[model samples]
Target: MTIYLLRRLFLLGTVLLGLSIFAFSLGYLFPGDPLQNFSGLRYLDDSTREQLTLAYRLDGSYLQQYLAFIQRLWHGDWGLSLASQQPLLTEIRQVLPATLELTSYALLVSFFVGIPLGILAAIKPDGVIGKAISAIAITGYSLPIFWWGLLLIMVFAVGLGWFPSGGRLGVLYEIPPQTGFMLVDILLSDVSYRQAALQDALRHLLLPTLALATFPTTVMIRFVRDAMLDVWEQSYIKTAKAKGLSRLQVLYRHGLRNALLPVIRQIGLQFSTLITLAMLTEVIFSWPGIGRWLIDSIYQRNFPAIQAGLMIISVLVITVNMLTEILHTFFNPLARKR
Candidate 1:
């Protein structure tokens, strides 16, 4: 297992190296001078452009620039955002937690809700409950994320006023940021009305989380259902049943562990999609997160922020895939033997 882990780690490093190179090269080759976004200033002059270009190291060859970027990355310097003139990492730090918090909650919703529906559907594939689950999954999968978010906001926030329209928390809550995660921050803070603050945070979180979770939940349901069905047909499943094992016992004790291998792999594989969907969900719901930050950077042509966001998100996606692969191997004895 140790050797396998080491090998996977090495492979992950290689994948990240390639991803960095691709992202950097794409950013470098992006059409438009880095200073062009600043060219509209009344007092901006040629020397200023030259100075800005030099400051950004645009004066160097592409290879030289890439090497500098690699060195900076190695030293944990993510560069400065042209928009804010602050460290890109600092800006990311402020926004990343919001995305993480939202995505985590969304994943929880998907896992808890989707898995059970999937199990029921698998148990009774042609039954009314199974058909209902299938219909729900299809609808969830087919709905556009922005549309779903808007529909949710209109119904829950606009019509019923059950939740706030946007933002992470109510301004009334003055929770200090220890972890940057709003829920955790609220729980850890010494603020008065902490319970109310936490509730407000959750209320704000609910709409976006549901919208972000929709597609992933559907995907999980389908994957789980299919995996369970496949596992249920295996010879061992029949043997367990014939041995007088109860249906639930056979399903839980023998079937589920095997079924979960596919689900586990899909979770990792679908992580990037989840992140992408979260970005759209954030935009629709006006949630403050890296997705919104990246959109603003693109509009402002903040190359450093754009590059850094790409690198960070890519690394996250790659890391998730690696972890899922490891889990998949660990769970599957056949994989271990191979």
Candidate 2:
């Protein structure tokens, strides 16, 4: 197990190295001035341009700039945003937790809700419940995320007025940012209307979470349903039934236990993708997350922010995939044996 983990860690390092190169090269690959934010302005003079270029090493050859950028990266310098004039790293620290919080809520809903629905779909494939479950799954899978998000906001937020249209908190609640997670920050806050704030936060959370979870929940259902069917026909499952185990035990204990390998794989695979999806969801909901922040930076042509965002997001996805493999090996002893 130790050897396996060490090998996996080494592979992870290699993958991150390759991804970092790609992330950095992506800016150069596209046609745009890295310093375009300062290109045409009466207030900006030649000496200022030279200093800015020198500071960013943008005046140097591509190879030198890349090397310098990497060297600065090693020293924990991510650079400043051309748009906000804030350190890109500082902005990432502020925004990443919000995204994580949003994604976490979506993932929880998907995992807990989808598994049982999936099992039911598999167990009673010909029944009314199974057909309904399949229809829901298909509907979820077919809907475009952006479209779904807008539909959700319009229906749930506008028509019903059941949830907030966008943003993480109501304007009335001024919870001091403690952890960057709204739900957590609300609790940590000592405001008089703390309970109201908490409720408001959850209300703000509901629509966006539902929109983000819809697709992944459907995916989880399909994965579990297929796995459950494959497990159902296994010899051990039949034997468990033959031994007079309760239907629930025979199905959940014997069937779900073995069938979970694929589901585990799906969980890991889905998480990395959820980040990408969260970007669009964040925009639609006007949530304060890295995704929306990146979108704004892109629109503003903030070179530093854009470059840093690419590197950070690429690393985050790769790291998630690596952690998924570690989880996969942990769950499936057969993988360790192999």
Candidate 3:
């Protein structure tokens, strides 16, 4: 297992390195000068723009800039954003946790809710419950996340006034930031602040989480149902039944375990995809996260921030995939042998 982990780590490193290069090259290839976006400001002039370009090493040849960027990366300098003129890492640190929180909650919802519905659907494939589950799954799969988020806002926030419309917390609450996670930050703060912040965060989280989770939940439901059906038809399941195992025991112990392998893999892939979706959701909701920051940087042509965000996201996705591969191998010994 140690050897396997090391191999996976190496592969992950290679994938990240390749992705960083690609992302950097793509950013470099984007049209329009970063300085031009700031050109209209009276304080900025040609000399200042030249200095800024030189400082960022953008004035150099493409090969030279790429080499310098790589060198900076190796030394743990991710460069400064043209927009904020702050270190890219600093900006990312502020936003990454919010995005993670959103994605993590969404994943939890998908697994706990979707998987159970799937199991129930599979258990009574021809029943009313199964058809209802199938209909909901299809609708969820078809709904665009932005549209879902807006619809949720209209119903829950605008219409019913059950939740705040947007932002991480209510304006009345003041919670000190410890972790970037609003829920955790609130809990760690004063009691008076905690209650309102927690409530506000959860209310704000609901729509975004549901929006982020919709497609993945639907996909998981279908996959889990199919996998369970396949596993139920296997000889081991039949043996368990012939041995007079209770139906629940045969389903849960014998069937579900075997069925989960595919679901596990899908969950892993969805988790990675959630990061990207979280960005879009964050933008739509005006929530602060890496995605929001990335979009801002893109508009400002902040190369360093864009590169750093993309590199970090790419590394994270690769790591998640590697971990999933490891988990799959562990769960099915035959996978490792192959």
Candidate 4:
């Protein structure tokens, strides 16, 4: 197992290295001088602009710049964003947690809501409940998240006044920054602070969470339903039924357990995709996260920030894939044997 893990980790590293090169090169290849935007903002004379270019190591051969970028990466310096004039790592660190929190909440919502609905649908494949579940799943999957978020804000926040329209917390709430998660910070703080912060955080998170969760939840439900139906048809399920086990008992203990392996893999893949989706949702909602930050950087042609964001995302994707592979092996021992 250790050997397998190490081998996978090495492969992940290589893949990330290649991804970094590709992302960085693409950013570099964009038309126009990358320093053009900086020219207007910095108000530097020609000599000074040249000096700044040299300072940023931009006045170099493309290969040289690429090599230096990789060397700096090795030393943990992701370069400074020309727009923000901050270390790319610092910018990324500030926003990554928010995106992660959003994705985590979405995944939790998907699992809890989707899996049960799927199981129920499978158990009664032709019943009203199953038909309703299928209809909802299809609609949810077809709807765009941005549209869903806007509708949710309109109905829940604007129309009913049940939730906050946007932001991580209310301006009035005093949330201590612990681990960059508002809810966790609240829980760890004093009661007065905790109460106000928790309420604001939860209220603010509701719409975005629901919008982000919709597609994944729909996908999970469909996948789970299919898996359950497949497993239900297997001979072992028939044997369980022949032993006079109740339908519900057989469904839960035998059917659901075997059906979950595929769902688990799908969940892992969905999580990787969620990171990307969270960025889009964050922008629409004015939520502070890596996604919003990356979009801003892209518009400004801030290569460092873009590179850092893409690299971080690639790392997340690779990590999730590795985790899913391990989980697949664990659930299906024949995978390990092969």
Candidate 5:
């Protein structure tokens, strides 16, 4: 097991190294003046241009600039934002937790709801519940995220107004940011209307979480349903049934564990999609997260922020996949035996 983990860790390092190269090259791959918007003018005086160039290391050759970037990165110095002039890491620290919080709630919604629906659907493939589950999965899989988000906004945000249209908190609660996560920050806050603040935060999260969860929940259902079917027909499942185990025991105890391997793998595979959806969802809902922050950075032509967001997002996805692989391998004894 130790050897297996060590090997996977080595592979993870190699993957991250390759990803870093790809991510770093993105700065040069796109056609843009990283310093063009520095002064927000079509043309600049030579002195201003020179200062901008030197400030951004444009005076160096591409190789030299790349080397400098690598050196800075090695020393944990993520570059300053071209737009705000703040450190990129500092901006990420402010925004990433919001994204993480949003994604966490969405995953919770998907996991809690989808797994049971999937297990039931798999157990009763020909029944009414199974058919309904299938329909939901199909509907969710077919909907475009942008359209879905808009539809949600129209229904929940505009028509009913049960949830707030956007933003992390109601302006009424002036809770100072303790953690970047609003939900956590709310709990830590000692405001007089603390309960109201907590409720408001949750209300704000509802629409966006539902919108972001739609696709992944459907995917999870399908994965679970399919995996359960495959596991149901396994010899051990039949043996457990033959032993007169209750239906629930035979299924949950003997079948669900083996069935979960693929579902666990899908959880990792789905993370990138979650990030992508979160971007669109953030835009639609005006939620403060790295996704929306990246969008704004792109609009402002903040090259450092853009590059940093990409690198951080790519590394996050890669790391999640690596961890998922480790969990998948660790859980499957047959794989460990090999």
Candidate 6:
């Protein structure tokens, strides 16, 4: 196990090295001068230009620039955001939790909800209940997330007024950030109308959560249903049934646990992707998450922010993938053997 983990760590380091190169090269590889794009200034005086060039190490060769970039990163310097002129890491810290909260809500909804529906579907795939779940899941999975978000906003937020269209909270609730998660922040703060603040947060959360979760929930339903069905066909499942075990007992005790090993892997795979995928939903809802932050940075041509975002997001995605792999290997005997 230790040897396997070490191998995985080496692989992770190799991938990070490659990703860093790709991220670092973007400034030079792209058409526009990064400084001009970031600075938004038509002309730069020689002294200012020289300073900027030195700061970003644009004056150096690619290898030298990359080494400087790594050195600065080693010292915990992620560069300054051109838009805010603050450390890029500091800006990320403010927004990343929002993305995590939003994505976490969506994941919870999908996991708990999808697994039961999947088991039900597996039990009676041809029945009306099963057919209904399958149809809804397929349709939800098929639709584009942005379009789905808009459709939801129209019906729930605009037409029906059941929920807020966008943002984290109503202007009435001035809850200061205790933790980045809005719900937790609401709970922790000594705001007036505290319960109301939380209710507003949920209302603001619903539409975006629904839109973001649709794809994953639907996918989970199909995946779980299929996995459970496959598990039920195994000889052990038949043996349990032959032993006169109740249908429910066999399904729960003998089937679900085995099915879940793969489910863990699937959900972990979805983890990083959902964060990046939230970009569209974030834009439509105007939620202040990493996705929206990155989008705004791009619009402002804040190349430093862009670069930081790329590197940060790359690390997150790669780290999640690596963890998923380790988790899968840990759970599956066949994988561990390989």
Tens digit per residue, CA lDDT, model 1, 169-232: 8888788889999999888888779999989998999889989999999999998999999999
**160-193 per-residue lDDT for model 3 (tens digits):** 9887667887778777889988898888887765
Please estimate how well model 1 matches the true structure, expressed as its whole-model Cα lDDT: 0.84
Candidate 4 Cα deviation (angstroms), residue 164 = 1.1
Against the true structure, candidate 5 reaches a TM-score of: 0.89
For model 2, how does the per-residue alpha-carbon lDDT over 1-338 read when each residue is reduced to its tens digit? Answer: 89989998999889877776765675566455545432212244678778767865787787777777677778777766766666667899999998999999999999999998999999898899998999999999999999999999889989998998999998887988888999888888888999999999999999999999999999999888888888898899889989999989897687878888767677667888799999999999999999999999889867667777878888887787778788888888888899
Cα deviation in Å at residue 95, candidate 2?
1.4
lDDT of 4 by residue, 130-243 (tens): 999999999999998888889998998899999988899888877667787767877888766667678788989988998999999999999999999999999999999999
Cα lDDT of candidate 4 equals 0.82
The CA lDDT of each predicted structure is: 0.84, 0.83, 0.80, 0.82, 0.84, 0.85
Q: Which candidate has the top score in lDDT?
A: 6
Q: After superposition, how far is residue 208 of candidate 5 from its true place, in Å?
A: 0.3
Point out where model 6 deviates above 4 Å. Answer: 34-60
What's the distance in Å from true for residue 206, model 4? 0.5
Residues 1-338, candidate 5, lDDT per residue (tens digit)?
A: 99999998899889877777775677666556544422223456889788767755777887766666676677767867777767778889999999999998888888998899899899998899999999989999999999998998888889998888899899988889988888888888888999999999989999899999999999989889998999999898889888999999888787887887767777788887898899999999998899999999999877667778888898899899888888887888887888
Better of 1 and 6 by TM-score: 6
Question: What's the CA error at residue 37 for candidate 2, in Å?
Answer: 8.8
The RMSD of every model to the true structure, in order and in angstroms, is 3.0, 2.8, 3.3, 2.9, 3.1, 2.2
The residue pairs in collision within model 3 are none
User: What value does the lDDT take at residue 62 in candidate 2?
Assistant: 73
Two-way lDDT contest, 2 vs 4, winner: 2
List the candidates' TM-scores in order.
0.90, 0.90, 0.88, 0.89, 0.89, 0.92
Residue 71 lDDT in candidate 1: 71
Q: Which lDDT value does model 5 have at 246?
A: 95
81: Cα error in model 5, Å: 2.0
RMSD of 1: 3.0
